[model samples]
Target: MRTQVAIIGAGPAGLLLGQLLHAAGIDNVILEQRSGDYVLSRIRAGVLESGTVRLLDAVGAGARLHAEGLPHDGFDLLFDGARHRIDLAGLSGKHVTVYGQTEVTRDLMELRAGQGALTVYEAEKVALHDFDGDAPYVTYLDRGEQKRLDCDFIAGCDGYHGVSRASVPSRALKTFERVYPFGWLGLLADVPPVSHELIYAGEERGFALCSMRSNSRSRYYLQCALNERVDDWSDERFWAELRRRLDPATAEALVTGPSLEKSLAPLRSFVAEPMRFGRLFLAGDAAHIVPPTGAKGLNLAASDVHYLSEALREHYAERSSAGIDAYSTRALARVWKAERFSWWLTGLMHHFPDHDGFGGRIQQAERAYLISSPAAMTALAENYVGLPF
Candidate 1:
């Protein structure tokens, strides 16, 4: 097989990159190790930055998102039984949309299929070959037969565990990592959201987030020990903790249903420098990952591919590799800023055993400062709503 770009992984990054390039009259192929159904149904990020929404709309991928996605002008920061609203629109002149990543993937996959883009699913032995040569190739097992795909460039949109990053020389890659002492026990319940806006509650019990995937389905998470096990948490215990953390004075209308899904995601921040080497480039989780506290995971991945697509377009049109060469530095500038914001939000909201009363007071004071100070609030709003791509 021959193409201009061989993309590994059919996640948002790889799939979107192919779509964008295809729109620009570029030829590309996508490879995935999982079935299309599995890729479209994976439980992932749920919040979309305003910039992400605009990008989707511009690319004509927001038809269903515009109709089904929920828009929130602000979010609630709860402490000591009181709620403070950070008016996102007032602070940044923009708002966020609550739509699951699965929906985005499904929409993109449908769009890709309509456009007749080639996507191989459940392909095995996916490996990058001759990435440093003039013609890069991706080899995999399709239908129990070995196949080699040749392309001018390769994109590693696969997750952190994929072979895209491993193809790089170990000595040339610089990795930075920080693993938190806690994780989040996330649950998806078939219930209506308690509040219209996302609620970040910091209580004496723990940290809880009230977010929605749709009008009829809600998603919530609670801070827990890093070593926590899903088998250890029961449905009753989960709901009780959620209630204690999101304790509201007034009895709001809420319908509790069985948790359809439950899992624990360990909090961590990881970044690998130089997202490109030779003819191969990395985008999204393949290159970096952030804690979900700031809700920047999916948006960041989309942003990475946006720049990469632009660079590839420039390379094809102007025969200039300048944009592609600077891809890493340009993308990392935003990556580190988000990393700091996610770290700050995670540290401020989550309760740690080592934090004494003094520490608790400090966190409360920080929260107070963020709410009362316009400058701080504006900074938070900018990071939370997302930066321009």
Candidate 2:
């Protein structure tokens, strides 16, 4: 098999990239280790920045998203039983939509199918070859047969634990990472959401987030010990813990139900410098990871793809490498800004294990200042809705 680009992973990042390239008449092939159903079944973040929404629309996959996604102008920051609102749309001239990552992947996959794009699911032991010297190719096993896909370039969109970044020589990779002391014990339920917009609550116990996948699907999370497990949290217990962290009014309005899914996710802020290794480029989780506090994970991936797709388009359309040469710098600049926002937000909301009363007071004071000062609120609002592409 031969193509212009051989993409690893069929997650949102890979699928979105394929859609963009295919829309531009670029031939690319996507390889995934998992079945299509399994890919769509995985639950992930639901927030959509305006830039991401626009990208989906550009690829002709936003019909269902716009029809079903919940749009919000602002979200609330709760501390000491008080609610502080950040007018996201008013402050930044943009707002976010509540649309699941799963839905986005589904949209892209369906679009790919409709467009006759090539996607090989259940490709096993996939590996890249000769990416650094041009004439790159990918090899994998399929149905007991070894297959090779030759391509001009490769995109490593598999994820953090994916092979693309790991394939790079360690000597050339500079990694920066911080693992938070705790994790977010998240639960998804079919209950109606307590509020129309998300709420980030800081409490004496820990941090809690009130977000939703839709009107009838509420997703909640509580800061938990890193060692905690899903088996440790019952539906009733999770709801009770979440209620303890929220304001009294929100807690009173909160609805409870059997959880559809429960999982523990460790918080980490990670970035791999220079996102490019010869003919291979990293996008999304392959290059960086941010704590969910800022809701930047999926949006950041879109931005990376946005930059990458544009560069590839320029290379093919104008016979230029200028955008390709500038891709890493442009993507990394945005990556660091998102990393900073997620880091700051995580620090402000979570209860650190080693934090003294003084540290806790500092966090509260920062939150207080953020809500009181227009400049501070504007900054938060802009980051929340996502900085410009």
Candidate 3:
């Protein structure tokens, strides 16, 4: 079988790309190593930048999102036993929506299906061949038989551990990574969030985030040791610790319940240069990763897909190679800015193991200045709402 574009991975990145390409009358097929149920069951980040919501709207996938998703103008930052609200909309003239990545993927899948893009799930041993040459093809096992898909271009939308980046030779790839000393132990429950908008708390002990999947379902996280085990913490214990980190007024209003899901995720920032290599172009987690501190993982992925789709569409429409040729440069310019923002937010919110008395005082002073200064708040607001594509 042959197509114009072959997308690897059925995550939001691949699904969104397929939707865009298919809408432009380009033929594309998506391959996934996991089952459809598994893909939808995996919970991910919920905050969607305005740009991301607009992208979904581009492919007619924002109806449910606009209906059920919560829109926020600002969030509270708790520090030194006080709450400082950063007005995202007021400062940046933009806002974000609280919508799960899973829901986005589901909507994209439906849009893709109607637009003539086929997504083949449960594919095994997926591999790309001859991507650096004129023609590229993918091979995988469907049940017990080998299947091949020949295509003009291959898109690596798979996550960091996926085969796309690994397929590149070490000599041609340059990777940068920084692993934080701590992780986030998160608990999800059906209880209402303590606050209407998210709360990002920085305390003497550590950092904690109060977020939500919806008005009734809360997702909270606390910074913890990298080696900590989720099994070691119980529902009662997790709630007690979380309350200890929050400000008094916020903590008093918090509701506790049996957790529906509990897990620990380590913090890290990673990026691979030159997202494009020949016929194979990498997007999303396949090319870069950011700490969740600033809620950039999914947002960055959307931006990558946006650039990629435009390049592919331009190439197919006017037979112009300008967008395709500049894809890597253009995408990386935005990727690096996001990387810096995520890193900065992580540092400002989390206490490092090596933080000394001087370091603590410096952080306190910085927070004080930021809270008192309008310029500082605007800078933070613009980055949070997301910069333009």
Candidate 4:
């Protein structure tokens, strides 16, 4: 097989990149280790920055998103017993849409299919070859048969645990990571959310987030011990625990129901410096990871796709390597800022096992100052809406 770009992974990042490049008249093929259904089954963040939405629109895949996605101008920050609102639009001149990551992937997948794009699912044991020099290619196993694809460039969108980053020699890749002491026990149910917009609540017990997939389907999370097991928490117990951390009014207004899905996710801040390697490039989870506190995971992937797609477009259209040469530096600049924000938010909102009385007071003072000062609120709002791409 031959193509201009051989894309690894069929997740949102890879699919979106293919769509963007195909729209630019670039020939590309996507390969995935899992079935298409498995990709959509993986539940993920639902918040969308304006820039991400624009990218979907560029590829003619935003019709369903704009029609069904919820738009929010602000969210509430709850600390102590009170909830203070931050006007995201007023502060940053931008707002985010509440659309599930699954839906976004579905839209992109369906759009690609309609355009007759080739995506090989269940292409197992995929590996990159000759990415350090010109004439890069990919090899994979299909139904126990070995196959090879030759391409001008290889895109490693397979994710942090996938073969993409692991393909790079350890000496050539520098990694920085911080595994948080706690995890998020999340539950998705058919109940309406306690509030119209998201609520980030910090309590003496722990942190709890009130979010939703839509007006009718609520998604909630509670800060949990890293050693906690998902099987140990029942729906009733999860709802009760979430209610305890919320303010009285919110707790009273909260609706309870059986969970559609339950899972535990450990929080972490990770980055691999210099996202490009010769003809190979890493986008999305292959490059960096942020805690869910800031809702930057999927959005960061979108931004990476944006930068990479633009560079590839420039490379093909103008016969210039300027954008390609600068891709890593540009993507990393915004990435580190997001990493800082997610780390800060996670620290401020969660209870720590080692935090003494003085440390607790410091966190309280920080949250108080954030709500009391317009400058602090504006800063939070700007980061929440997203930094410029």
lDDT of 4: 0.94
**Lowest-scoring 10 consecutive residues by lDDT in candidate 2?**
363-372
Displacement of residue 75 (Cα, Å) in model 4 is 0.4
Q: Would you estimate the TM-scores of all the predictions?
A: 0.97, 0.99, 0.99, 0.99
Q: After superposition, how far is residue 180 of candidate 2 from its true place, in Å?
A: 0.3
Residue lDDT tens for model 4, 151-186: 999999998898999999888889999999999999
Cα deviation of 48, candidate 3, in Å? 0.6
- Residue 138 Cα positional deviation in candidate 1, in Å, after optimal superposition: 0.7
lDDT of each residue in 97-176, candidate 2, tens digit only: 99999999999999999988889999999999999996889999997699999998899999999999999999999999
Residue 103 error, candidate 4, Å:
0.3
lDDT of each: 0.89, 0.93, 0.93, 0.94
Candidate with better lDDT, 3 vs 4 = 4
Best by lDDT: 4
Q: Worst ten-residue run, lDDT, model 3?
A: 109-118
